[model samples]
Target chain A: MSSEVAVSKTGTRLRSPRHMLADSATLGPFLTLLVLFVLFSLFIPKFLSWRSVSGIVNAATPIGIVTIGVTLLMICGEFDLSVGSLVALGGYVFAMLLLAGAPPALAALLAVALPALFGLLNGLLLVWTGIPSFIVTLGTRSIYRGIVWLFSGGTLIQMLERPAVLALFNGRLDVLNELLPKGANFRTSLIWFLLAVLVFQYLLTRTTFGNHIFAAGGNAQAAAAQGVNVSRVKVISFAFSGALAGLTGILLFSQFRTVRVTTGAGMELSAIAAAVVGGTALNGGVGSIWGALIGVLLISMLRTGVILMDIPFIPADNFEAVVGATIVGAAVLNTWLGQGRAKR
Target chain B: MGRTQDHSEPLVRMEAIVKRFGTITALDGVDFEVEYQQVHALLGDNGAGKSTLIKILTGVYPPTEGRIYFEGRHVRFSSPRDARALGIETVYQDLALVDTMSITRNFFLGREIVRRLGPIPWLDMRAMNERTRSALRDIGIEIRAPHEKVGSLSGGERQSIAIGRAVHFGAKLLILDEPTSALSVAETRKVLSYIENAKARGLSVIFITHNVRHVHMVADAYTILRHGRKVGTYYRGELSERDIADLITGERER
Candidate 1:
């Protein structure tokens, strides 16, 4: 509607304090991770040890992987509570396939594919039924966990004697071996986790699909008007969440050589916590993979710190208190960073 | 009306369109047409089947008993994507933009320029940014950076960007659904002028609004609907703003 109305003469657009704060919102998570790392190292000398650092990275791998998908789905304004259940389901699938004489790689692929399929179903149900994703995924969560229990017969699936299958994921990196007298036990899962992060980060920031995701999540009606298949975008996001959970399950299985019925029982909450701590808005359309990476690292470090400190009040088994506290704290900080002065 | 353009074929024509949701009829029978290179206004009150008519034309829904012709060819669009593929773009009042996204991304939301590197198409970020800057500038919307988020922009600025995007993408029929209902007088004028600019560029516009005054300034023809039926189609010079308003509000007996 161009008439005699001139271009906005609002002067040169200066970066306002509001814009700066919004930018800092993303950086907030990374900064918190850095601050926590420094504080931990200062107070707990063990945190500075190469062993502790490696252990933190190793433990962070599966959680980081799960966080990647959860963060992506969250950015698209959907939640997948079933990821924890999917992880357990995947472990059972892998274990069952391996026992059935299937090659480890094939078992692993099927394991990943199963959860991806479930994710697709979750997304389709959400889109087609016009139900809130939280409700749909919440229903699927228990259903998937039940399926896993049925298959496993409520018994632990254990393969304690490590085969080449387990070795592929839990193998140590030779490069870091010379740095530590005990030999660097850097788990291959960490490499896989970081690789997933880099790939997803590229997808979210440097691709057209990534742009569509933000659009769909930010405003579905707007996205639909632009001819972006919002339903497809959401479905794909759910699949990513489910598939990553499966991969994390595989990693967990490889690391411990055991899959309990409750292997990933409360992991969905922890994964969400990690993403929230990394500055991912639960409301959606504003987040980063790098932030989630930092978040998972922070979560792992906190868990490890509590265990190392041996604080009588906060037992190692009760690390969830720290996680719950961090989630609340991070959520508050994120809101503060995003809260700009109201527009006049 | 206004300047005559040789009475060529209309760009879009919907004949006796009737839509029903269950037993309730939204549109009984309505005929609407928009000539090429003219701003056609659709005026109606609430529940006057204006939304139903627009939805049918835009492929959001198919009429229960009606046929739509685009460029004199009968067509049935199952979804909005199909309609968009045929060069029909609708800019809703909300502007259909993701505020959190960069202006460049919003400009090329579904139609992104990608470098065909391997199987995965990587976004041509630099090219897209440059194009968005020039595109918005052509429409008299100047932002400091194309990479700036759309949320930071004012309401009118966002509408301009949406209009610019539709124009750049070669839309044959640009539909504006109450584009000025939420804008200030200045912003409304700016948007109205852009509609005029679009008409000059040979794009047919379906300007849907209850405000007859704004439409009077730009629309070459007016189609007024009342009680899910068309009252009449009047040319610009044939009716005053008051007459059109009465027609929309059903104040004047048929």
Candidate 2:
């Protein structure tokens, strides 16, 4: 009799509207993406074409990859503004190493490791000096970009010789492209992006380290009192952010076959905007990696839709105004949804 | 209760603990002890060094001059983690729980159960959820589900979860800092029962509070501190409620 009562009570709670809303934190962004997709398809001719869809996906790849790290760092209650510069730094390091006759694999490893090291340095400075991460990364962003400028001598480093390994990162997906309609353009970079999303989402949801990340961000003092190494978690998170940014640089170079000092300038704001639109909390400890991916796709779709619409007053070069409005609107909607869930 | 066979040595003993923060002495030559299966109440007014003494015991700070013995062996802690490794758990006044997280997640915050998928470790959420529910139920706290956010629970329920987590994690010494101060009368009664339940399970608890009535209700032995000095340590019935109050306020002679 007692067990029956317990079961029924749990059943009621599981079916509660508040519980349903809490479980659907990512649902709002996903629905918005669908609605926008349908509206764009209805109004704009050729907007639903495979060519156009793949273009949006392809253009979102680099920033999509960067947002993965940015979201993780933000969830841990820290920020890495240096990632934009780190992206260029990564491209320079990879391009220089390859130009010097180094092995492609070795160059790639160092490309990722160097940025990760700088990220670790950022974490060390933040922890040791007790400075806010925003200030620390803000300072490092200039220093890293300066390094990129010095390395490239403020010129573009273009590779005339394309290595076979470059194809592994951003090569055209010939088989999928052949299977799709004419003008379809897909790349291996999208696969890598999706794989990263899966692996990181798994890490954030299914690992002890992931639990520590949430706890450290949610309540640092409480987590420390419970024997969690909050500083180590934060430092490691910073390293991950750097590594991912470096990976983004590799992807960018693979596609363009060139590295410049201004390769990823202003990308930091875009990645942060994507993370916030994906329902990640600015204060930390509440987010989903899947939501981040959706956010990237949503923003890219918006960009494509606005260009297709070609509104009289809004030029293609000024599409950022629309994207900015979407970021704020999505954030406001997420907050309202969160409050509704909490109130219930 | 039968685990109290070894009465010759106390579970924990702090001798001549003098903690000085620059020029201010937070704890001066304070001696305290807790026996097996006993609830020892450490009582004091504001700035009476109760927090300092607890901090030293839990390895948050190193005493300027003192020695601590646990289970008849000398012990020194550089951090709270070291103390926890020795089966010492402290539920702070804030409870050290992440309100945004689920009850099961908060219950297994630091020590999580994981299954290795090759080189990767995956949290065994099903097993953890089951264990969390059973553990809370064992401590007489039945809930709707383990996945409910801890923020939704009442103050009393939250305290129960914290205490239940400590007990489930194999803590030999549980230090609760003002566990009932923020709770209502009914919640206080529930927490007091939880303390009794912990004592019944053979764990030595250090109940730190300012409530003399609460100390009178559950503490097997009580220690009072006034101005960073130990007034006395007395077993139950040795001091009445009025006497404990007077001693706490420095109104009675030691």
Candidate 3:
């Protein structure tokens, strides 16, 4: 009779909602982002406009590109903090070369290759020394940033007047007007952004490389036991993340019409916040490009909301503290609630 | 199950298997044999060199001195893949799966089905998922969707999935390292059934555990280990479950 009763209770527990989501802590970030969106929509009036929405997406695109790449590396249980430095390096290298009579396409290509080389360096140093990625990237961050300063002399290389570069970056292709109501023009960057996202999605979902990435991150020893090339996955992931950040550097330079040594300063934190906000775990092995886009959108929303609200307590530039606090707060809340659910 | 050897054929042979971790000898001159088409129970205590011997078999750590024979041919496995290529697979306690990935993806992870396109290649998701679904169903694990993430599966279900992966990959000798150690009674029974299914398929399995109950239920023959040495090898019908337990917990002699 006791055995029968125990069996019934076990079955009940198995069928319960709590038991369903206890699988892994991957969904914590996704749930938190949803809750945050609901909360802000209820409270913030300026958050609902189409202009506001598009603006948030525009802001997210550059960071979305970087976050996607970093999440791929993070999925492999590695980090590349030198990405911010790589961004600065990428922009400066491209801008200087373009000024020295390089073609616009060539300038753009170097921007990607230079940082990819830096990524390769980070990879070789990491494997050879067997140091944690945090320490390795810290050292490389300083090296890359110093090169950015030396190469560009700590001055903004104003590319606003460069007609060739401007055409690619500043050009607008109005394909969205056909889909939406009148006067809705599509920026070329959005197209580029979507294409990149789609390509990464395909690689992650439909290619063998995606499998290798997850295997390497989930358990390197087990992956190696399964005949996976673990080292190559780490190298490629980190290098790819850095290279993607480089693309953003060029994009950022175009948007701001300038490139300086500190062009990518503090971008890593924001990228990470967006990635975490989107549904990526700090421990890695689970993330979505959809979640990341949403995460970046959330951050952009928070920024815009704070600005439009004219929150007088904090001044501009120092507002990053508030933003940082909010993101960390979200992460903490997400982790706590997710753990509680898993326990249940 | 005992020795079902019709011919003088031994599938795997270990001669003087020696392993050391710094000053401590984990395995010392242990000789073990696994015949084809039999379920072998590796009985041992926490420090009875069970893990070391299994590691050597799966090619995680090289034997300090001695040799291994696979199908009567001398084989030196430098990696786990090397061991698997010659037919060896291990299902550890952790399951070693990415919880977020789908069942099909996890099953065909390292050895994915792919279609070549000129110089490029793409993973064939449909074929892989179909195989994974059938593999699970064959073991009495009727998972509703092969697209379901492995983390979503219950403990027993996860074991079923893991076992299915091993069977699909054609591992001749599957080394299960304490499979039912942390499982519920029901889950343990499910795992035992899966082991029987694998045995029915004529796959030689090394069911390593200290649980004599586990061995008594599914194992054909038992190889007992104590203090880095083989105590004895006994046929299943010759000894009782309690006696096998005594052997594992050091309560009796060989």
Deviating ranges (above 4 Å) for candidate 1: A1-14, A21-25, A96-101, A180-185, A306-313, A336-344, B1-7, B18-25, B64-67, B237-239, B250-254
Between candidates 2 and 3, name the one with more favorable DockQ: 2
Q: Give a tens-digit lDDT track for model 1, residues B1-254.
A: 14344456688989999999998999998999998887999999999988899999988898999999998789999988889889899998774788778899999988899897888778999999999988767756676778767776677878888998998888888999999888889988988888887777778999998998888889999999898999988897999888888778878865
**Model 1 pairs in collision:** A1-B190, A1-B191, A1-B193, A1-B194, A1-B195, A2-B193, A2-B194
Model 3 reproduced share of reference interface contacts:
0.38
Instruction: Report the C-alpha lDDT of model 3 over B102-201, residue by residue, as the tens digit.
Output: 7888888888999877866788989998888888777677766676666555666777777778887787788888888888898899988998888888
Task: List the candidate numbers ranked by DockQ, top first.
Answer: 2, 1, 3
Off by over 4 Å in 3: A1-51, A172-186, A314-318, A336-344, B1-7, B20-24, B115-122
Global lDDT scores for all candidate models: 0.85, 0.88, 0.77
Among the candidates, what TM-score does chain A have in each? 0.91, 0.94, 0.85
Least well predicted 10-residue stretch by lDDT in candidate 2 chain A: A1-10
DockQ scores of all models, one per candidate: 0.54, 0.59, 0.35
Candidate 1 to truth, TM: 0.89
Candidates in descending TM-score order: 2, 1, 3
Report the Cα lDDT for residue A105, model 3: 90
Better of 1 and 2 by TM-score: 2
| Cα distance off (Å), candidate 2, residue B173 | 1.3
* Highest lDDT scorer: 2
Q: Which candidate gets the maximum DockQ versus the true structure?
A: 2
Over A1-344, each residue of candidate 3 has an lDDT whose tens digit, in order, gives: 11111224323322333334333334544565577667777788866665666666677788788887877877778777888898888888777888888888988899999898888888888888999887999899899899888867778788657465754764454555467654444455666677778878777767888888877776676677667888888888777887888888887877676887788887777777777766566776666666666777777777777776677786555668767886777667556644543332
